[model samples]
Target: MSHRAALGTLAIGGNPLVSRRVLSSVGEWGGARVGARGAGLSTSMASAEELRLVARIATGDEAALRQLYARYGSLVYSIAVRVTGDRCAAEDVAQQVFIRVWERPAGFDPERGSLRTWLATLAHSRAVDHVRREQACHRREQRQLPGAPSDVEEVATSSAVAERVGRAVDALPDDQRVAVLLAYYDARTYREVAAELDIPEGTAKSRLRLGLRRIARCLEQEGLGAWT
Candidate 1:
């Protein structure tokens, strides 16, 4: 089937056989759930209708999935486009977001936040990953060029510093570590991190502050404070 036809299947409903076929067709594009915890809105923030829709989706009600897509498709696509700066990439990210929901509807925990927030977070995360991969590919291509600059000593020093930083980050508490990584490694702003992790902006800032302070202390203890 053409790519558009394949994507069209994402919204198809009412028949178990057709649903399974569509799922199988889209299975080649793997997906992962966003399970990070954030100090944001609580279960009370999610509406009863949204919770019921997710429950129905979990039971393989493709019509419920269609309802979900119709409700949030534009939002997801818009977020993806903003992050990736490519309409085509945005479309791909949006499709993957819905596919993930279809495959693992149970992953949506109303206790964490609203379904709309969850979908937005998932879309942003996927878009960031897409952009990161594209940049990595571009970097690889640059490195392959004949006259690409190479500095052995600088490379070694950078590698050592990166290793130490990685170790320091890993030593952080789970929640702080996620916040720190999202803010630093993922190049997300404090607001973006809050949105992506479903945390309030203040909470996101606090996590970054605490995480960075801890990492700085760690580096100081190791005589690497200058690097921090």
Candidate 2:
């Protein structure tokens, strides 16, 4: 199953999905510090502490991994949310960041930079990657549309569709929602969607078909079928 599908199944099984709110309220990351001198000391302490945590994690200490997550999870999730502008995608990005750190503690080089900076850089890169992929998919979708409408028509239609379709997207199941976002909304071809999502091309096609059908049904139910 797709990543979103798996996450949805887990949610159905009463497993909580980690999100920005979850990360923010997760653990105390050394509380608050005020003043320039105090801020500098906090930075120094965090860097030193993070380095130690990385070392411990590399040595198979699970507690150190938890500490690392507590320290950087909120910042990572915030960066992702800011860049992606989509909570679901941001949540996926945040989870991937911590998972990467957990599996490859040595990826962070203390001599090169502090752990926070490293994680921030990784988060930014991932979010940007997500944006570019979505843009590419959107362009492809536009290319396949019946024809280019007049400039004024295009502008007005885009506004209406974006607002209406966004609500429709939210109502879809996790797997279908993600596929629709990447395909019709983002404009990815089935092959491109399959490649990006690491799914078989046939599966991507099936998901898109199912998702679009559901979206159409939703729009119709909401009396927006004519708009679609």
The sequence of per-residue lDDT tens digits that candidate 1 reaches over residues 24-115 is: 44332222112211211222234687889988887888777766665666557766775665677776777778777887777888666668
- Cα lDDT tens digits, model 2, 1-228, are 323443443333211333222334433322311111122223433656677788886775656656666555666766676567676777666656765665577799876666766887788777767777878687433333312112212333223434565666666776666665565334356787787778899988888888888877876786654322
Candidate 2 weakest ten by summed lDDT: 32-41
TM-score attained by model 2:
0.45
- In order, the Cα lDDT scores of the candidates are 0.63, 0.58
List ranges where model 2 is wrong by over 4 Å. Answer: 1-43, 140-228
Listed per model in order, the count of residue pairs whose N, CA or C atoms clash below 3 Å is 0, 3
Error of 2 at 167 (Å): 37
Measured against the true structure, the TM-scores of the candidates, in listed sequence, are 0.48, 0.45
Estimate the Cα RMSD of every predicted model relative to the unseen true structure.
Answer: 15.6, 17.4
